[model samples]
Target: MRAIKKVKKFIERSPNSTEGITFAKLILALESENEFPVIELYQLNSDEFDLAIELLKDWRIDCFYVGKAKAFDSATRAKNLS
Candidate 1:
């Protein structure tokens, strides 16, 4: 939760900051399923860069679980409809 807050603050505080742009680009790259914006990570200092990576990992896991839950709910609804 602390990390999540930190990430939110990082983005909201300076959306146009170098770290923010790098983070946003990385997010876009992930959504596109392309190579990570590894080069952009260099824009951040070590701590910020590490936080970004950790946040990505956590967000990915959370998204996976949410997707799985939604699929389960859809399947259950379809089963009931039949």
Candidate 2:
């Protein structure tokens, strides 16, 4: 709980830290409990956020609303993966 709070504070102080911290914390959490936690860490753009979300979706981690539509749509269309 303390670590999670620290991560949240770090994110608030440095919004750009999402991807790295998120991935690292997620791996740690999964390793510890064999299951992901349910929480939304905002600030990642949709495409970048989606990559992480998809990786953990089956584990029940939920990463909600993170990017502008234009950017997300463009990325989705360009990659043809959405």
Candidate 3:
């Protein structure tokens, strides 16, 4: 529940960001517990409460990681830096 509270704080601070909107949708899906697919799409958006708050406070809040992609050249995948 503490984590959920942190998530709420992040949303409150950046209510207009694309990430924030997606996160809001994810929370709705989670609360309904009947929209797993929608929730799945935003699973990666979840952030640690503390870190999420910091990102918001600093105004650098597009804080979710994108999925890794296959490397075009060598067979290695690109590492996620988020």
Clashes of 2: 0
lDDT, each prediction: 0.80, 0.56, 0.50
In angstroms, the error of model 1 at 69 is 1.3
Clash number for every model? 0, 0, 0
Tens digits of per-residue lDDT, candidate 3, 2-42, equal: 44566677689988876566557656754464453434344
lDDT of 2 at 54: 57
lDDT of 1: 0.80
What tens digits encode model 1's per-residue C-alpha lDDT throughout 1-82? 6555787777888899888777777667767878875777766899998898787887788789989999999999999999
| Segments in model 2 whose C-alpha atoms lie over 4 Å from true places | 1-17, 34-40, 58-82
What would the TM-score be for candidate 3 when compared with the true structure? 0.42
A best-first ranking of the candidates according to their TM-score comes to 1, 3, 2
Worst 10 residues of 1 by lDDT: 1-10
lDDT of 2 at 25: 69
On TM-score, the candidate that comes out on top is 1
